[model samples]
Target: MAKKARVRDYDQFIVRLPPGMRDRIKDKAERAGMSMNEAIVWCLEREFPAPVTLEDRLEELATMVSMLTDSKDTYSGVVHLIAEIEETLDAIGTKGGIPADTKFSDMVRERLDYWREIELDSWRDRNESPFDDANWTSVEEPPEGDPFPNLPDDEMKKD
Candidate 1:
């Protein structure tokens, strides 16, 4: 038997785009090969993302700190930065964002996991490592001291 079609209970809005904006949206929709509505929604989602839960924030901070600790100046800073791009590329190719013939799990992944939480799929996707409590720092008490309090004023002696 064929599967039942998924119901789309989307709210409708009639937007008035100025001058070339409509054409731009249409072009983007065409390039991404998605419906104008889908393209618009993708843009909106990227622009106004959901609030980061406290757990998520802590996880991000932990990941950054762990990676930083392991590296002389961030273990794989380039990859980390690329992975931390401010925008999501969901509408890069097709309706699914990824190629129609490809599955997300099958895509090439170069992982560098510093910590892990098995229960969360997002955490698992980032790569998994056994958690260590010692790698954490409390936000309430940050490290003290300024290495350069008076620049261009304090002279250093060659010892």
Candidate 2:
């Protein structure tokens, strides 16, 4: 049990957070045997840490801004690339035809399939291909001799 403090007036504030965050916070508070207000206070204390110095805070803010800027730049680049690709494809379509002459698409698709098949079989040795011993050559060896002349298997074994 703890002593209760009386308050003359309390300030009320409303904020919207991502869905399920509030529910998760409430669940955590309930598990910790504390009220939602107490849990929120604790969480805020942890989340909003005290910076050692103004410079440290400023550096953190700068890093956050840089990250945001980088994200925006990357998104813009991707959008540009997609637009360029679409334009190129549209140009190709216009140069060719809408349905692409049926035979052309079919031939292109068949060629692509044939290329894929070739890639798939690139590492394989076909039955028709002879096993050429081009690099097969035996190395000269020394005369046969006892590898372990000083040691015996019975002596090496431990009881």
Who wins the lDDT comparison? 2
Most accurate candidate by TM-score: 1
Model 2 C-alpha RMSD to native: 23.8
Candidate 1 Cα RMSD after full superposition onto the native fold (Å): 19.4
Least accurate stretch of 10 residues (summed lDDT) in model 2? 91-100
Please write out the lDDT profile of model 2 over residues 1-159, one tens digit for every residue. Answer: 446756545455687879999899899999999998889878887987543332343355456545656685755554454454333333333533232344544554566568657755873544334433343343533235744334566865643
Question: For residue 82, what is the lDDT in candidate 1?
Answer: 39
1-159: candidate 1 lDDT, tens digit per residue: 557665465566798889999899999899999988889999899997765433454466467766777678654663464355211222224443323222432231212231223225665656654343245453443325744334344353331
On a 0 to 1 TM-score scale, where does candidate 2 land against the true structure? Answer: 0.25
Tell me the lDDT of candidate 1. Answer: 0.53
